[model samples]
Target: MIPHLWNDLEGTFFPESALDYMPEDRLREVQLQRLKAVTALAYDRVPLFRERMTAKGAKPADVRRLEDVRRLPFMVKNDLRDTYPYGLFAVPMSEVVRLHASSGTTGKPIVVGYTAQDMDVWKQAIMRSLYSAGFRRADVVQNMYGYGLFTGGLGLHGGLEGIGATVIPISGGNSERQIMVMKDFGVTAVCSTPSYFIHLIEVAQKMGLDFKRDLKVRRGVFGAEPWTDHMRQYIEAASGIKAYDIYGLSEIIGPGVGNECEYQDGPHIFEDHFLVEIVDPATLEPVPDGQEGELVITTLSKQAMPVIRYRTRDITAIDIRPCRCGRTIRRIRRISRRSDDMFIIRGVNVFPTQIETALLKTEASLPHYQIVLTRKSGLDQMEVRVEVTGDMLRDSVGEMEQLQKRFARSIEQITGLHTTVTLVQPGSIPRSAGKAKRLLDTRNEA
Candidate 1:
């Protein structure tokens, strides 16, 4: 059986690498070997890893199997912040081939280095992610996920090149031109944040561009933020392409940690290079199978800065079951929200995504919405401001009022909070080409 409905894509998917097809037992063996080697590297070269491991009563030799990774110390973003630029590099500056840093918008940027081999692994992982999303040599991929200091741009550039696709390093912004390139250049695929793609839909509509008739893109790889199925449907319908979710963090190997295959079941976590664990964010212990918790990852193949059980703070559940794509790697539930993003209002935990999911479900409401949290009269108030579609606008006032009441009920149903849903005119909500800002709490803004 071959996937040939879309032209001669006889082999759009790369041959399963040993990492992709290795048996579970053999994969575990490789993980153990790499884990032991990295543990030795971090313990011997980096004082921080050695001190932490020594304090935890574990030595490199003590970690004999993949299960032993739990005994080793956990690495947090603060560890990277504490080390600053190169404190955790296993190799010297001369051996390090590249450097990529986080935005550090909150505070100190977490820096990561890559040796030549580390870079090679990164390229391979990205290729795996692309292959799963149906990327092939014949496809021309537009790398729009930012470049420089941030790993999304260059990492994806190298990845598309590795997969033998024609790479377009257009970067971000210039929404109209991006759509123009897609129309004129015969661009076949795209990778960017889901929110940005939705914005592109708006841009295309404004340009009077018809995606199905005017675009050649067959599939899209969307990542960098948590998007609901409502968002996916909106993007797919607007772009006329099957949408796939990609998951990664700068601390890990970037956007290739996992991706959705054509099956689109879940993003396959590349367990061969990165060992993933779902754990209670508060307790720092592994969670039950198929349970939702924080995502923790340990870099088994990284040389410059191998992370051991680094707490990702990303909330997701490991499916434990294999994917329908036939890849043995375990899959992770789409990222719901980060633990830090979880805010309890009136004893009910709520994430901005919850509101987005609820609003997107309503046909009359546009995907653009904002959750404004404020303290008024000594009580926390949650108000969801959403845009109404043009059809809803053209309708009578009674119709709009009923839709608004429906949206309010849906929000209350999802977040267990009595809420206010304000319907706004289209284009009123700000659209971001990067990560969409969804939450604003006036109580904490001071």
Candidate 2:
């Protein structure tokens, strides 16, 4: 693989090539320099950072080494909310070229801006992600990730284009048209949420389209949702392609934050663009490398909306080493689950992704389901409402009951918690345009 000019510059700055080969002191020295630069920039440019640092009695000059970064106040999502809109943008509006906002399901959307250079950095980071996933110049990428405000579609689209691939910007939804384009364009690669990909597989089968013979896709870059190894195997088996995991969030820079290589071991992070740190979610103290914690990011190269020590709320670990693919950048494992997404159900920590993984393993005739948590009689009751398609029904009440029992067992096996399973008719659950809402908590009494 040919390294981009930016990658070459990154090597000079950090000697990432030596991460696995160099001494610990050397790596610390490089990180200390970068940390100081970021701290100084945040102190001088961003008002929120300046105020927080001042209140914490932190000065840019104080951050003389990597350890000093711990003295700086950590930034969180709420800080962006406190500032609102573009108050957190470091550079003036004149340099801002593009803006992307959060889906805002919780409250007011946190906005992120990009300058021309920032966009270039984003493109490079995403390109590295795609390259790691075995994308080449000859590959025809069909990006099914949503476009517009959501960064997945456009981010991957730009990176694929940057790599000189034929990018079919096929946003998301329109299952019929998506398959049609895949066949007509001879698309070799696909990018989308793992659930949406599974839904498309079923659609193709129902439409009498042969995934192996008709569709030319050989690889899938699945992201925008938490998935599992079992789900990955199922996707690969159903689609006759290798399914690689990609990771990103709009707050830190969209879908190309990190990506799994062809080896399918772990997603390598572009450390040159964004500095990653894993910290205890509650204590905010750095965890030892190779341990799971909340991922915190610092935008080292961004201009318009440079964020320092921004807490991502994502739970994952990092390996500060080069991969067999020859990329010297650090690699981050696929996110286990977001800290906020973890819910305590009767003293058991349950993740919705775990339930989704269990459901996918079963021969359940449904691609859609919702995990609803409600308080009843002073205790939390969990219900999984799944949509049953025609394939699973097949005029057999015996089979339906067996399947429901199997699903309940599967959930128990994965989560160690009992959940009521409700198999509804097809098309019962509503479809969403962005970030599908699969989990609902109605515990608070009105």
* TM-score against native, each model: 0.95, 0.90
For 66-164, candidate 2 gives per-residue lDDT tens digits of 666678788888887777899888888898999988778789988889999988878877776776676777789899998889888889988888877
RMSD after CA superposition, every candidate: 2.4, 4.2
Give the candidate number with the greatest lDDT.
1
lDDT of 1 by residue, 210-238 (tens): 88888899888989877777777777776
lDDT of 1 at 332: 90
Candidate 2: segments with Cα more than 4 A from true spot = 1-31, 320-322, 364-366
